[model samples]
Target: MTTTASYEQLKLLKQFIDESKTIIFYGGAGTSTESGIPDYRSKHGVWTAMTRDGFDPVKYANPQFIKKYPEKFFAKNEERDNRPVPEPNATHKILANWEQSGKDVRIITQNVDGLHQKAGHRYVLELHGHHRLWHCMSCQREYLSEEVKRDEDNIPRCFVCEGIVRPNVVYFGENASKDTVGKARRSMKAADLLIIAGTSLTTPLAKRLIYDFEGDKIVVINLNEVNISPLKADLFIQDWVGEVMTTLSEMN
Candidate 1:
């Protein structure tokens, strides 16, 4: 069951949302769990691949892995492509709503799934790049999701140059795009309120970003431990993101 913070904390969060003009949202895989996407380090998350599937993503989805086992790398991505496509759930919807309501809301997400864009959010910075898009290494031509999926061998190639196409997602040993990083930092610096949800803040990047926030209010919503100290958050809501967002929407 998802846990909820005390009434006082909820009240404080509501007030923060009401008062803040600029809000920055930083989300992780947990943000999409309600949409059927598994998180990376959770109990049954993708990181469990070692025990569950006999191959960890670190070994299968890395740049070195792609160099050594191209077929296996594409096959793994093919499996991911075959999984049910997930739609944005309550959390995504609420955030989108805030954007539509003329709130200066910007999202910085670690998820590669384009759920935020699908949810009608316009200004989203994808820290992990995109999952449904790919580019040919030789020609740099982009391929749509369908075009990439049409390959029988699972290894997509450029139609124009026959160059190997690779997913835009960040593999192990890769850093996020410099452009994305700069924008995220600028957004956080400009935000009057920082809303972090569905992340454990385990990654160095996540910790650094949150710790650098100069926002007036910092709200953390999560079902699991976020690694951030409770003292750092103006309001810490321990709950499913979907549940919390739905309740907040209703309260508005």
Candidate 2:
């Protein structure tokens, strides 16, 4: 399903990669869609499904919701933990190869899936935190996701402080990790080319980070149009991230 226009855009992206010494791959939920993960804003995504069920996904996924309805929150977490783990797709492999091949590449992702690291990417900044990691709310002790399974009452408790244990993800209405954000900002400022992929830039923090890039060029590849004002993409490809990345790899 690769169109001629998409090939042309791939050529441009290749040229950008060739010219730039430092590159940043800023990714979102759509980056994992090819790996059987659903995006948040897409029509059939998590948000849409929540809305269809008469629930506000943002409210339901918030940290406050965890306190107000511990059982419900933990139940949702249990369900998510029970789902099959998704594997890294072409996009992740391509980016990881770029980094391994000595292309000064860094990844700044808004996804909690940890697919980038799963694909052997070393320089990844998880802006949204990771789901595979868990932490105690009171003791701040960390644990792997598997170590903190919910009990029969649908509550995962920290063994040390007997406190609530939650995934190490930045929920809606929660501030992102300042350390991660600062590191990402530094990478953006140092990058010569920034590739915005798989995201509509709907999240305010993600949008703000995009604006922080004082890079030489910006390349956007997504299945939808990106309408961020005052910031025009040097190359925009309205296509699948995996397809675009796969083609780009082939070009090289």
Candidate 3:
């Protein structure tokens, strides 16, 4: 059931890309790492474990907990806001060009960095939301990231209502956005070639989106193996994202 040789597999992938009018890219943390973004779940990532008030810090900042002790919620999450900025890398640039070329139809990503949009891909589904927003729960107000620096507080409170402000990215306990999920499904359904790249697919929500792809060719591109063997995947390449994308970009 497999191709005769590795050469055939790569050729098939490039051929599929050439043929498909609709392409959907489902990406993960590794997608943005070339841009200097820290993948918080990766081995090299910085954020991990801590405990506060006898609860796992991750759990304590969820919407439910934020509704309760917002001061601590904002306190715990300020790090995400203060994270160093990352710009678009080769992988992101190649995809952006693909979008402009009308080959790439949409991007569905688990990253909150907004790198895809930054690289000039206009249509993106951010399953985890974006870090560019600073949101205030009390006033239901939102501000750009730069605006927060001027505010004289560590865990900034809303000037209107003194409610806690947190970055807008999705947390562990929250459901994936229904709009993102539904749109992702439709994109996958319409795609002739679906590329699952720069993703371990280990985390929540992303694996589900991969399952939604019933396209002609399913490709998994990552630097390492993943836990679930993709049922529909026709090819798996353990290569760094930018290297592979730069290769793929030349197949035009």
In terms of TM-score, the best-performing candidate is 2
* 105-143: candidate 3 lDDT, tens digit per residue: 688898888888889998899988876897887787997
**lDDT per residue (tens digit) for residues 1-252 in model 1:** 454666676778889989998899899887999899888887888778654878876677677777567788777666777889889998888899999989898999999999999999999999889967888867888887667733576677788877778888887888989999988888888999998899887777777777667879888898865667633777778888888777777774
Reference-based TM-score of each model = 0.92, 0.95, 0.83
Ten contiguous residues minimizing lDDT sum, candidate 2 = 1-10
Give me the displacement of residue 92 in model 1, in angstroms. Answer: 0.8
Residues 1-252 of candidate 2 have per-residue lDDT tens digits of 564345667788899999999999999888999888888888889889878988798889987888778898887666666779889999999899989999999999999899999999999999989978889888899998879856678798888887789989999899899999999888988999999998998888988887888989999888888876798899888888888888788885
TM-score of 2: 0.95
Sort all candidates by TM-score, best to worst.
2, 1, 3
Off by over 4 Å in 2: 1-5
Cα lDDT, model 2, residue 122: 98
Question: Where in model 3 is the C-alpha error above 4 Å?
Answer: 1-9, 48-57, 64-84, 149-153, 227-230
| TM-score for predicted model 3 compared with the true structure | 0.83
Scored by CA lDDT, what does every candidate get? Answer: 0.82, 0.87, 0.74
